[model samples]
Target: MTSISILKKWNPRPTSLSQMNALLLRIPVSSPSMSPRRYSTRDRELQSAKLEIENAPIIRNNPGLSASVFRNLSKFIRSYDLMDHMLKVYIYKEGEKPVFHQPLMRGIYASEGWFMKLVEGNRKFVVRDPKKAHLFYLPFDSHMLRLTLSGQNVKNGKKVLEKYLKSYVGLIARKYSFWNRTEGADHFLVACHDWVWFSCINLILMS
Candidate 1:
């Protein structure tokens, strides 16, 4: 949904309206629900806490995630009033825009305006400037994570991620092999799949 539509739905603070606008425009056409429509109380908490956990060790998983990505995520989280506005946006509000002030857990937030556009840049960026995607993916981290965590819950997160990739439009990630098998495209494994262990794993889930 558009940011204006979201603003009308929640009646939230005016300060967030601009941030919401900036976030909504970056959503790629493929992922419609790329935006959220608020969640139940339990879900809100999970998303908020998860954002915190992700910011901590996310760098280790993906060395490609640059310091700027980390800075932006922390800055967003610090502004969003943590889980307070997070839950409000999920439960009381209509869309995910209210989350701009919260921790930058996922790329769905898109608060940076310019950053997400950079993330969506040419695939050449993937091979050359891998770090750019990290800033863009931070907002959608929650849903990307949930989709990955679907089947088995805790341990399932990894495999669930693989499953999600297989479902993508072109399924490039699906057609590619991660472990050196000849079944899928070599590029998918080296560029996309490895990202899971890298910082943009959550970002890829968002894409």
Candidate 2:
């Protein structure tokens, strides 16, 4: 079945978050497959960009800027140029509001929210096709997850947040072939919550 159809039929259980967590935890690790040779195009492009950056000449035109500040000014310039010209990101549309696809534009975590809004709406780097994407964005707000799941109570918040994130990842992993292709190596999340460090680490390790 098509991903869209599969997504439509698949439903998250409303019994409890713990039950959902149990189901998500059982999502098996997908075996690496070599069938999708189309990804090789992205690999080639990255290699080309890397070579170009490595061979780039030093930018001595800026008299005010010192080379000491940057490890390699030429490489940095080339990297930025390549990213601006070629980067394409695919955002999954399977998530719901407050936690996914919604941005929190206030408070200390505002940067993550603003970044999500900008990137999701961006035409230059965002692509609708997963095949053309160089990266995948998991658009979940950590702040919102905390608020929606745990509220003012902080007890076991870390575990709750981690489970929710894991469940989201599991959903996408099952809905699309992208996550399994790289085993989430190309997937990224924008989270700035204080507990993000530990939660993200646990998520990655568990995934």
Candidate 3:
């Protein structure tokens, strides 16, 4: 199911290959389907990705890109395109502000906030249905959490963050069958905090 292979499965290929490519870009690797299995769409998407990666050609740059760099770079480029066309990300709606969806614009960690805002605002790669997404976004605003933690005891702050994340993830796991299906292999957390290592300790333990 490589993107190219998927395109070729149809009876009449589009006259404009580029247009077909563009349309394919909107087809996420995992999408809501009429299948009984939870991973039916995921499996299909994974097959497509695997085929696309395996079939990507190696572009020789002679003296330009080293062989190793070329291979890695090519893989990244091909994978990125496939992801753009087929990666569907779902942002969770649980939790309240100061920790949920608020973005911090004026700080070193603002990049994470900005990234979150952009993704949440961008509809091209986002879908309302969780079942249709390839990746699940745990939209915890670490920037806001940092601010709130500034006033709390250091040890207590860490525990608080861990508790919140555990609770949040637990809620999703219990309320929906997604986490239970894959053990959260499809879920991701977006963060730019220098302390992300410690902050994500809970996520690791739960995973």
The backbone clash count of each candidate, in order, is 21, 0, 3
lDDT of 2: 0.77
Q: Top TM-score: which candidate number? A: 2
Error of 1 at 157 (Å): 2.0
TM-score for each predicted model, relative to the true structure = 0.21, 0.76, 0.72
Please, what are the lDDT tens digits per residue for candidate 3 over residues 1-207? 222343356446446756766787897765333222554676588778978887877755545547554435666667878987888888888878888888777778888788889989989888999878888888877778767765666556666666667777888888988777767766787786745555564464365
All models, RMSD in angstroms: 20.0, 13.5, 15.1
Better of 1 and 2 by lDDT: 2
lDDT of 2 by residue, 1-207 (tens): 322344466643566656766886797643343223345787678768878998998786557567666656778877988999999999999889978899989998999999999999999999998888888898889878777987644666666677777888888888888877777777888876646755565576457
Cα error, candidate 3, residue 51 (Å):
2.5
Candidate 2 residue runs with Cα over 4 Å from true position: 1-39, 61-66, 151-154
What is the alpha-carbon lDDT of model 1 when measured against the actual structure?
0.36
Between prediction 2 and prediction 3, which has the larger TM-score?
2
lDDT of 1 at 24: 66
**Runs with alpha carbons beyond 4 Å of true place in candidate 1:** 1-114, 117-143, 146-152, 169-195, 198-207
What is each predicted model's overall lDDT from 0 to 1?
0.36, 0.77, 0.71
Ranking of all candidate structures by their TM-score, best first: 2, 3, 1
